[model samples]
Target: MDTSTGATVAHRSWRSRRLDPERSLGLRLTLTVVAAFLVLVPFTLLALLVLGAWPPLLRLDASIAGSFHGYARDHPAWVGLMTVWTHVCGPGPLRVAAVVVVVWLVRRGAPRLAVWVVVTMVAGGLLGALLKLLVGRDRPDLLDPVARAAGYSFPSGHALNATLAAGVLLLVFLPFVRYSGRARVALWTAALLVTVVTGLSRIALGVHWTSDVVGGWVLGVAVVASTSAAFTTWRSGSGRPSAHPLREGVEPELADQRPEGGRA
Candidate 1:
């Protein structure tokens, strides 16, 4: 072959390999970096606002807190419900639930999936706590408060942990419902409801500002996305078939493995 033609063929082959998402670690790393940038940028901006005590955000936080506190003070029933919801979905309870899930996964012979759950939750929880300490923002101080909590509250731990739990549960169960459109929709809807309401419960109880909840939500999402991307990259490197989390769950192979109970 002519030198020019040989060069042309090599160039095309190189371009094709780079563009192949399944085999290209470079492409995956680039995507992971972009996703982290997108998630962290807003979170950092929010943290800055909190640290600076920006007047506008403070005003917004006050306005929402006042409104929610006003209603909470009047309706003893509503406050009661929120208090229950917050504790049930709080960081402590969620962490316990995650431990149970990890045990379940291990018993089912999915140790890797179990580790992912533990790592995702532990990393998110620690990051949230670290940010809270660094930000050193206080809880909403309201007269006649209906509910009380003790912590540095820039990012609500309840919100952060709940978001992590919701995301983990949805991904773990997605494979079971992958073939049923309605089941998939229900799973997503449930996750959204839990994550949203848990955060809202914190605000409604006058324990956290809206911005704190937002920061937690954003950070939680970033953790999940970052870890999921890492898991995907690992799967690709390990010769596993590429599967979308939303469509096939983080561990699609789990669907084929019966729980230990079913084996005997």
Candidate 2:
């Protein structure tokens, strides 16, 4: 009995070491990808800025807005959905929702995720603000069939906030969903489609230039990638056990033992 117990202990110890390998590797890969994206986005943006592409992009945005305005004029029912989306993407309620999610994460899950949530929120807002100020691009003067308040409109706040909220929420929720191999692909495809439509809505509403929407997208992606890296690294280093209870329960068995006869 004593010998068998000793063997089990040794096996478990070895398995634990083998399973983790290096906790930092996932974090490192995430950081590397984010860094590559960051380097690429700005260079592309600079080229567009230098080539004076803003005029055409703005015109495109205006045309989209005009199209939507015409549609709304023709179909009054469509106005309701647009209003709902505008409200959902607005600053006040979205910020409150972000705070609530962060608090929930800090209390129930790893605090690292919560911290990243907050950081991403702040970074998204600040980056959008700075870009808008620096770009100083004018909002569309063309009359919208549906009137909106006047503002400086490079890097649309609606697009930025919507993308930030949706992207971060997806990051937080993805780990929780139990997706089969095929389901995961479908899930990601749907998520991409929703994100694209939401961004386009801002341009369609005459609230942002096309370049503004593109910049918002770039910033949102950067924030999600970088925050995911930082959070993963922090959680791995803490060694406080997974905050995910289900994961904690299964990890020991899976990580510490191999299937007999190659059957799971």
Least accurate 10 contiguous residues by lDDT in model 1:
17-26
Off by over 4 Å in 1: 1-19, 260-264
Q: Which candidate leads the pack in TM-score? A: 1
Global lDDT of model 1: 0.90
- For residue 92, model 1's alpha carbon misses the true position, in angstroms, by 1.1
User: For residues 170-247, could you state the per-residue lDDT of candidate 2 as single tens digits?
Assistant: 666554443355654555665565557667766656565566667677766666656655555455556644333122
lDDT of 2 at 143: 60
For model 2, where is the 10-residue window of minimal lDDT?
245-254
**What CA root-mean-square deviation does each model show from the true structure?**
3.0, 11.8
Query: CA lDDT of each candidate?
Result: 0.90, 0.62
